[model samples]
Target: MAYDIPPDLAGMNLLEIAEQVQARKLPPVDTWKPESTSDSRMRIAADGTWYHDGSPVTRPAMVRAFASLLWRDPADGQHYLVTPHYRQTIEVEDAAFIATDMRDDDGALAFRLNTDELVIAGPDNPLRAEGDPDAPSIYLAVRHGCEAKLDRSTWMQLAEFALERGGDDLAVTSQGETFSLRPSA
Candidate 1:
């Protein structure tokens, strides 16, 4: 079946389209459902093209699809994915120093560490199943009212904080590897 394009996304970049998709600025048909289970599932074609259930996705529709997936929150409601190993408490915003090292619902080794550093992995990256024994593990830190910084210590501290809180609602997952963090309350 053919899908109609959203008027607003007639001309926009992938990022802009993604934003619009998240905002619900376009119709639902315009977005791509990456997690769809059937052959009729919509997807972005290999050539950077968009498709819905096996047909070409219109430019506007493709933009909306990319936008929705990119901007949509994976977290339960309050959490955001900084990376595979790092997630910050949304309620805390900036003051909360939080992180975690636990298996998600789908059973992937997940890590959440807060730091001012932008680096997420190092020579001995913890996220890796097995790598350099002496490699360093970098952390991604989010500072209050400031951009996130990269440092090893900061990530460790964030993880420690989240561990102390001890609650299940804070962590959730949609697909096997796609994990998200939410506040306990």
Candidate 2:
């Protein structure tokens, strides 16, 4: 799908774009999932180690859970229950990173991230809405990164990428810049 660049993002910086994407005020599409499930549980041991369902959780799972906690929930009283065994695989190729996550129902969540671009595949693909006549996958691409400072165009792009990709292989550059490119799992 093609994105129509918003006039407000014409001359923003990366930081500004990131903030705008975080705030969801950008015109470009921003897509995301729950980032955490509502059926999982966690516990902390006295050693400062964390456990999920009596077992040690992996770093990625922890990150996802933390990230989920940071997301604004649609349901005011509902909370995510992230699974300790929730496994995600990420693969990076050239300018794109492909991430796949397995849901409890055996369904799949796939995400594609590239420099300033994001796309997702799952039960709800927005691309389908554009008359692709197929289940549309969500797609967002950066039009101009260097000029996207306050517009958060990149973050909005990443959000779409994460929503489509399941946030498993989600990658951010050293400068906190997000990209679809990632290393293989």
lDDT of 2 by residue, 1-185 (tens): 43444444434444554454356323221133424344335443322234566686557545334323222224442323223423222111111111221111113222222213222322222211111222222232222111001123433453454556575654322233344333222
Q: Model 1, range 18-134, lDDT digits (tens) per residue?
A: 343246442232133334222224443323344445676567544433322222233443322132333322222221222332222222222322321111222222221112323
- Cα deviation at 71, candidate 1, in Å, is 7.8
Q: Which candidate is the best by lDDT?
A: 2
Model 1 RMSD, rounded to 1 decimal? 19.4
Please, what is the TM-score per model? Answer: 0.19, 0.19
